[model samples]
Target: MLELHLNFCNLVEIPDAIGNLHFLEILNLMGNNFSTLPSLKELSKLQLLNLKDCRQLKYLPNLPSRTDLSSKRSLPESFSSKKDPWAFERFYDYMEAGLNTFGCPELIELERCTSTALSWTLQILLQVHYQYILPSLWNIPFPSIISSIIGGSEIPSWFNNHREGMGSIITIDESPLMHKGNNCIALACCVVFGPPASRRKAPPIIHSLNHVSVPFLCAEDRITEDHLWWFYVTSGSHIWSTKYENLKLQFHIIRESDIESWSFHGKKYGYRWVYEKDLEESNLTMICSR
Candidate 1:
């Protein structure tokens, strides 16, 4: 079979023989009860593997090189990639395939998993990006979306170049690492949105505006009651002059009711704002082409 979905079947174990399906492109085993998965190295064509909400799953096999593996609520410290860190890197490499560990709570010992496990996962993501020199997503040619938004109102402590609590404008100074000459420029912007707190009869509708002089593709998502919005954007522009030598990026989150006061001066913009913690790891990485 080219595609197989056995999600939430209350399955405890899968036979090893399933791996013989060499043509499988998508294998979905989400919401199952299994603790470990059988190796399917033979499935070379496998592209998308969804193990979301597999709370009991404690292990993930080394999927194909291009495989996009996504698992949320996979709270176990199951990524034993001491031999191959690539196994863990693939999880966040595909920006289109979100790794949503938000709202996934579990207990390992006396500590809450949201803090401990999530920390480990983000660390690995940063390490992979640093070691492997993260490749570009197929949709964009330069300045890949190599960032992620964890499910929390507050930004993580490890974040770099960040401002804390309220207000929308953020400035990123030009880094020496960025190549000179703006032949092509891109921003790996990630913003995490949490449920807005409102005490009135109606809850506030949150929105983030991008008021920068850059070419960015904007995508709008339906805002539900308590969903964490994951925003990753890749932008490239040559029209920018050397006037922006410092490159101060503005990221903001505002309420829907306040959109009337905001001016849309024809700049390419998107909704939602980034929680500021200045994750030095999560920088406004600019791809300045030489």
Candidate 2:
């Protein structure tokens, strides 16, 4: 019964020696610097793996034959792919329509957004191992899911709209806002790898309000509130200015001055930044409500 708690140590890589802990039951390696995970095929008794902010990690290794992969349950839909036998082809088609030109933008914009989104997804799965497996393992393998989501297969309609809108306006090029004020654009994409929720609400709203100014973008009125939230704001962006109605929030902001260079981790790619603001606001409510 070997239990490991290696949280928040800023480790850059998983040691191959971890495979020796065959009796290991729990491993909490959250908040580390590890970009890739060590092989766990030898640890048949392993149970829980917590990798909350191992942001550097990009890919997961193949699991042992008996390992249950669905423990985390809420795998992002984007990770679902067609190449797999369980590939939700219909779902993929719908998502593609939602994000593609027939679905959202012109061909160029669709391609660009899809490419960037896929790149990010691959980067996340490169170094880790599937901690848990879903009861209903998709005929498709995990690697395929990573490829589909990142490559630009259709996602939920909300995501398509959000991606299209953002792709139309934002470019990878440095923005003026980054130079004048402390601001950067962070793009996040998650692919639920489990069963769909029975009663899911619309996707969260992505908002970017000029932090330096006032008048606050009300939650109900903000354009991003209804669809997949993809926000691009400067360092001056603020959430307090908006009206919130009981939502769990997590955010990370990176500015132009902060980034040093682009690098690769596993199949994923990452850009290093000098500064980043990461925050998680739980049970968020509007100030007016109070």
Candidate 3:
């Protein structure tokens, strides 16, 4: 077959029998929860495979042999200079085409710096480059200036040889940030620095509507009533209150359209009567760019 479209269906996995179609050139498996795919070693003619929006997919298996080292016709000439014949540009083009053809939502472009960092992280994880960077974090001495900024206690010596330290350094097993009965809690710490003169300066000011209990959900998990929510006014400055002492807060300005009303200590803050017009105007500009 020249093309096969399987979109918006609740498929949990691909059937191994698909490999029987040796002439199959394109297969779209979008909008599914498939965590794994069947081997396609027999489909020598396969040219494209789409797995867009397969959020649960954590790992991809090795490509089949016919498409591997022994292939007579190689990847495009543009990708020949790279160590791996299958260069990233080609993969990204294929991915984008697949997503568009398979009815995936349009990609949103964020701020340049934020998008660049996110793309780098995704590329590193996908290419398995964790082996090179993870260990170096452990080589840095504990109680160092960098560690203290991100609230890390100390660096371990074992990480000097291995680079896959993502799991080791971000352990939340005994962390106070984890809530009881919520085994899904995870913690990630990173140190972000601005100019040298502003190294110790506080972060931006963020004002929350009220003290509300909010649930923090993991990206992999589904939204549920079990989630809790907590709200507080936070900024980068060091502040002490008898109620919330020595808290380090970072502020984020979400759109006012997303918020319902302001609440402080379980009482309504009456923000609607005061800041509604200005908040709405700001929301319009901020939401569109993001």
Candidate 4:
């Protein structure tokens, strides 16, 4: 089993044998009855452990910290190209829609995010692995999920620039971050979106045509949350550079048939998705937290 949610079970203690579920990745013990958590060092594959509102919880073990691709699950064989939710066509539509979502994107997007994140992490993890080259022998693949969970509504600490409102141009100097950035190995984007929309308007975006995220989205609730995207981009030179290109993030461009001809960001292609009934068209703004 990969997940175990024992939230609000009113238990006083947990058995140490749980640590033996080596394949476990997520263990949520919120509102459980316990002051201390048992030693969880054996859960080598664990990725997330939620302990929210565990009022009695007073201590935790030296939890496993390895965050790599060891737990990456391949797409299942049950997947069908036409009948399934994560069909290729749905993915293409989402891509053509600029890859934006109502709030939290469907987990299928996780694959895209993971690929890009790997690029950004490769530059750093490669250096770490190099130090132990003899022991590692590079038998493992390096995947990263940098958890930027923070308190309140502030930009994540990793971003380089940020601003409010839409249609704003946050310019990037050709050789930006000359002294600070890590040679611009990759670009990560975060967008806060969504407002409650009725089923008529929300179904398309919420139950996104791609259907890959169907398992992730709760159809009954509103998707008012932040969405993040990462891209493995190459700097003009040296793979990644201190100086970067103009990273223009244009959000909420109400495009029409003629909008693409003059819009450089539109990439010379006509956008056809605008005709749909926009029941709750969101106001999108890009705060470049590079």
Candidate 5:
């Protein structure tokens, strides 16, 4: 078969026979219970593989490389090189056929960098869950979604709707249809970790809109360092969908006193608001980044 759609099927595993379908190109396995995937090294034509909402999935298998390592086809006399059989020129030649306006080199490189960053961030979250005892925070179900991380203690002042309390109401003038163009329908927050309290678990951060409560895992660590823990949720994910205009959104932290400073994680935008505490980590941040 050329296409397979098995989303929301409560699937625990996929058989290896899937790779045998050399002509298969699309595979959809979202909203399932699988934890891993089989190798698709033989599916040369495969593309558009979707695994969204596979919450239990923990890892992926080896993917086929861009070239066939075992192929014995003879090379042209002019192209033969004595150095490395698989040289940069060989790879470039292989890519020449598919290089187009939309799939240009720069766009491809950007996609690659984004993919790498997403993968690294997911790995960090997975390890955090298995190894730490910090208050459990829920993570986005899929790894392919665009996300980011930064360290800070205060909410950026740009969010004119924010307030000092654990929960506040904010309104937007746009409708749900207008938000379709945006990748994320939800927002995330960075909970500031204050002085450690022994044997006390911090409360989960909750976002309520239209009577739906979005519970996020509390961030662990002392605010002494410069780093903000981020968590995101999509609209209508665990809650009923609500329109964006005149939105009644509320932020709730069960133990507001424990949270020294907090801020919303702006999707696709960097923060211009700097808190006074950020200066202390200036040296360490520069050293690590360099």
Candidate 6:
């Protein structure tokens, strides 16, 4: 096979058989339970390695030279030390070009806020992938649940319901037909920030979760003329079990800054999902079953 996607499978370990696939080009192990990977030395053609939320993952085997790796957190020192130092430089250039095409000025501000530009850029870009881009790109073959939030006084037309405050509880009841089979994959949300200037006093922040948190696939973007800080959960994450009668989604935001270490502003906005059963799919295929 040329590709293997075993994301969100609750897997504990990968079999050595994977390395036997010499022709495999892409391997996605996002949101799994594994702590280490089987050696991939035999797969010379492997190119993309996605380890988005392998929380316990502490090690990675040697990979092909052309392979590109993506993760929300750091990999082991053995792997990170081997990274091409210029990779993030090239990535920043690419992102700058894309943003410029759309008149995005945030790139300039983002660049000015970091001493370790590579880490900061990757952190932000990863949000773009999970919250906005991934859902659009994975629509055909994989139906996913992607959602987002931004700083706005009004809710967008896309959401089924909205509340006046920071957090809300949303629950979805299952159908009888789903007993035979189901495609319930993920949950996502979009959060809006109040104002950028109000956040200027805070320090550079790393994102995290609190209060019945689930895994997240996140992204953010600036909409010109909107003046709202929007964050979206675009693709695969927010896993809930099939046995539960209702799916409860809860979210919140926090802020912090380290003045002695980093001079940066941090802002967080809380958001919650309103489960809509019969979701329209011109943009995303929300298939209820596999």
Task: Give residue 4's error in model 2 in angstroms.
Answer: 0.9
Q: How accurate is candidate 6 locally (lDDT)?
A: 0.35
TM-score of 5: 0.28
TM-score of each: 0.39, 0.28, 0.26, 0.38, 0.28, 0.28
**Predicted candidate 6 versus true structure: per-residue lDDT over 1-290, tens digit per residue:** 76577878999899988889877745767667776678776765554455655556555454432222222222222322136643432222221200011112222222121111212222232333333232233332111211211112333334444434342233334322233224322233333333233322223332322122111212212222221222233223333323455444443222111111211112223333322232323222222111
lDDT (Cα, tens digit) per residue for candidate 2, span 115-225: 333332222222112222232445322222222222223343322222232211122223333433242223223221111223232233344421111011112121111
lDDT, candidate 3, residue 250? Answer: 34
Q: What is the lDDT of residue 287 in candidate 3?
A: 25
Off by over 4 Å in 3: 68-290
- The C-alpha local distance difference test score for the whole of candidate 5 amounts to 0.36
The lDDT ranking, best first, is 1, 5, 4, 6, 2, 3
Query: Between 2 and 5, whose lDDT is larger?
Result: 5
The candidate maximizing lDDT is: 1
Alpha carbon lDDT at 182, candidate 6:
40
- Compute the lDDT of residue 168 as modeled in candidate 4: 17
lDDT scores for all predictions? 0.37, 0.31, 0.29, 0.35, 0.36, 0.35
Compute the lDDT of residue 84 as modeled in candidate 4: 67
Listed per candidate, the RMSD to the true structure in angstroms reads 13.8, 21.4, 21.2, 14.9, 21.0, 17.0
- Model 5, residue 170: C-alpha shift (Å): 22
TM-score, candidate number 1: 0.39
| Candidate 5 residue lDDT tens string, 38-138 | 98767654433455455565554433333111212223334343455434333223211110011111122332323322233333233222322212143
The 10-residue segment of model 2 with minimum total lDDT is 97-106
lDDT, candidate 4, 227-251, per-residue tens: 3322222222132333334333333
Output the lDDT of residue 274, model 6. 22
